[model samples]
Structures are given as C-alpha cells and as structure tokens.
Target: MDELLIRLRNPHERERAFSDMVKKYQQSVYYFVRRMVVDHDDANDVAQNVFIKAWKGLDGFRGDAQLSTWLYRIAHNESVSFIQREQRIAGISLDRIAHELPSTLRADKHYSGDEIQMKLQTAIALLPEKQKAVFIMKYYDDKTYDEMSAITGTSVGALKASYHHAVKKIEQFLRGEE
Candidate 1:
C-alpha cells in the first residue's frame, strides 16, 4: 500500500499509479454505487466521478486512511449526491422509488436478482442515504463498524445504531409491515 501511495505521489508514476488504483478498485466502487443508485448507468457515472475526485485530490491525501476507505468515502458521497439530485429532479423520495423498484429491477438487464433479492433491494432502497450506506457496507460488504466509521466519518456507536435501525426496517419491509 505504501509503495502504491509512493508511486501515486511521484509525478512520473502518478498517472500509471492512478490507473492501477482505478483498476483495483473500480469493480468494488461500481457495485457500491450500483447498490445505492439501483441503475447501471448512474453507477458508472458516479463511479467515474469518484475516481476523478480521487485523482484530483491525490496531492492532498495524507494517507490517514487506507486507499480503499478513501475511495469508499468518495463513492459514498457521490452516490448520496446522485440520489439526492435524482430525488430533487424527479420530485420523488427514495421510498417512492422503492415502490417502483420492482418494475425497474425487472427491466434492468444488469440486475439478476430473484423475488426475495428484489424485496431486499427495495427495502434497502427505502433507507435514507446514510443508513442505506451503513447497511450496504455492513450487510453486503461485511465491513466492520470501525472500517465503516472511517469511510463514513461516523461514530462507531452511531453506525451501530443506524445498522440496527436499518435491519429492523428491512425486516419489517420484507414482512410486509412497511
């Protein structure tokens, strides 16, 4: 990691290093965005924005966090921004979007989930951006609260509470209690 950072910081190696970093993190970043945005094109655009931000911010990076964490943080911010923009433009909340996810999922060629998976996704989509990010990082990525804290800049205790609430909400949604 240190070697990669050094290479990234070196002017001569910067471009190549950034490209390598993108290659290493792109898929994970895309999937993270995809889960948040629920669409391939939006995920691709947001993921591209994340990498662009990382590249532009590379000189200021202090290496206080792991590259992956930094990238995830960028991804999280971009995803939230994209969703918020979508909500504003469409004049629809994520909860309303969740209600439409079934048909959206059905039409998405990239989505291959079954009925239960769709239900889970819809439930997740209903969460506020931060809670949804916490849930995805914990439940899907199996990220530790500490790791999530670093990525989200949230306190571990708060993240835990958010995760707990997110779980309860998902359970309720799945049980048709939402």
Candidate 2:
C-alpha cells in the first residue's frame, strides 16, 4: 500500500500507478457497487465513474485512510447519488427498484447464481438503503465496523445496530415471514 501510494504520488508513475491500482481494486470495487445497485450495467457505469474520479482526485489524496477504504467511500457515495438521481429522473420508488432487481438479475448474462443465491439477493434488495449498505459491506465484503464507518461516515455504534437489524430483517425475509 505504501509503495502504491508512493507511485500514485509521483508524477512520472501516476498513470502506471493508477492502472495498477485499477487492476488491483477493480473487481472488488465493481462487486461492491453491484451489491449496492444490483444491476450489472448500472454498477459497471458507477464503478467506472469511481475509478475515473479516483484518477482525477488522486493527486489531492492525503494518506489519511487505506486506499481500499477511500475507494469504498467513493463507491458508496456514488451509489447513493446514482439511486437518488434515478428516483428523481424516473420517479421510481424504492419498492419498484427492489421489485425490478430479480428480473434484471435473471436477465443479466453475467449472472450465474443458484436459487439460494438468488433468494439471498432478493432479500438483500428488500432492505432499506442504509441497512442494505451496512449488510453488504459487513456480510459480503467482511469489512470491520471501523472500516465501514470510514466508508459510510456513520458512527460505529450505529453501524453495529444497523448490521444487527439488517441481518434479522434478511433472515425474516428469506424465511418468508415478512
């Protein structure tokens, strides 16, 4: 990480460093975005935006947080912003968005999930936005609370409660018990 940071901070190595950074982080970044947006095309666009933003802003980056944490923060903000923009432009309700996900996931050529995985995705889609973020970062990404707090700007206590509630809700959803 320190080596990557040094490369990123060097003008001569900046482009190569960014390429290396993308190679290292792109899959994780895309998966993180996909978990948030649940649509392959949308996630692809947003993930691209994240990398572009990172490239543009890397020179100004101070070494406060780990690079992965910084990237996650960008991805999170971009995901929420995209959702909000979609809601405004299309007037799509959250329920409608969630309702549309299964069909999209099914139609996506990239998707290869089994029935259980599909069901789990459906349950995840049903979560409220913040809870969904908390659930994805914790359950899928396995990020610690402090890491999530850095990414989400939520307090650690709130993130813990959110994750607890998110897990219970997901359990209830998967069990067909509302």
Candidate 3:
C-alpha cells in the first residue's frame, strides 16, 4: 500500500500506480457498479468514469479515509449519477429494472451457483437507491456502519435502518412476495 502511495506521488510513476490500482481493484469496482446498473455496458462506462475520476483526483487525495472507501464513494456517486440521468431521460426507475446477469450465468444449464447469485442480484436491483447503496456497502463491501456513514454522509442509525429495510425487501423479492 505504501508502495502504491509512493508510486502515486510521482507523476512519472502515476501510470504504473494507476495500472496496479486498476488491476487490484477493477474486479471489485466492476462488481460493485454492476450490482447498481445491472447493464454491462452502462456499468463498464460508469466504472471507467469512476477510475478516471479517481485518477484525476489522486493528487488531491488526502488519505483521510481508507483508499478503498474513497474509491467506493466515487463509484457509488458515479452510479447514482448514471441512474439519475437515465431516470430523467427515460422516466424509468433503476429499481424497477430487471437484473442483467452475465450470459454465461443465464444459460439453460441452470448452475445452482448462478441461479442463486442471479436471484440475489435481482433482489438487490429492486431496492430503493439509498437502501441499495447501504446494503451493498455493508454486505458486499464489508464496510462497517461507521465507515459507511462516513462515505455516505448518513447517520449510522439511518444506515442501519436502510440496510434493514433493504434486507426485508430483498427477502420478500426472493420469496416471490410483492
């Protein structure tokens, strides 16, 4: 991590640092964004934007928060922006959209792993944006409520409530309950 900081400090070393950063975090970022947008192309675009934003902002990064937290915040904000823009343009709610699983996971072979993951993703997709954000940060990112509050600028209680509601909604969705 110190090596990454050092590499990040030197403009000459920025490329290598950025490359290493992407290699280390890309899958996590992609999965995070994918969970939000569901569409591969949109997730890809937003994930790219998240990295580009991080790269441009790297020089100003003050290390106040863990780098992963900062990156997650960026990714989260970018996803929200994408959703809002889509909503404004199309009058469609992101939460109402169906989850878009990878083609391999949607195959007729019906891998139990894929089926369960898809169901979970679909349930997540049905959550309200803030609740979904809290759920993903807590469950998927393994962030503490305090850390999530800091990243999201919400109180811990509110974050907890959101997560709880999100879980209930997901459980209901999974159970085929409206």
Predictions in order: lDDT: 0.93, 0.88, 0.80
Candidate 2 has its poorest 10 consecutive residues by lDDT at 93-102
lDDT of 3 by residue, 1-178 (tens): 5678778888898899899988888988888887787667888899999999999999788877777778888998999888778878987665445543434346625334566678887777667777888898788878899888877889999898899888888888778885
Task: List residue ranges in candidate 2 displaced over 4 A.
Answer: none
Q: What is the lDDT of candidate 3?
A: 0.80
TM per candidate: 0.97, 0.93, 0.82
lDDT of 1 at 69: 93
* Candidate achieving the largest lDDT: 1
Q: Give per-residue lDDT, candidate 2, residue 124.
A: 84
Give candidate 3 misplaced runs (Cα > 4 Å).
94-119
lDDT of 1 by residue, 22-95 (tens): 99999999989999998999988999999999999998899989999999999999999999888999998766
- Per-residue error for 132 in candidate 1, Å, reads 0.2
Could you report the Cα RMSD, in angstroms, for every candidate shown? 1.0, 1.4, 3.5
- The global Cα lDDT (0 to 1) of model 2 is 0.88
Clashing pairs in 3: none
Model 1 TM-score on a 0 to 1 scale? 0.97
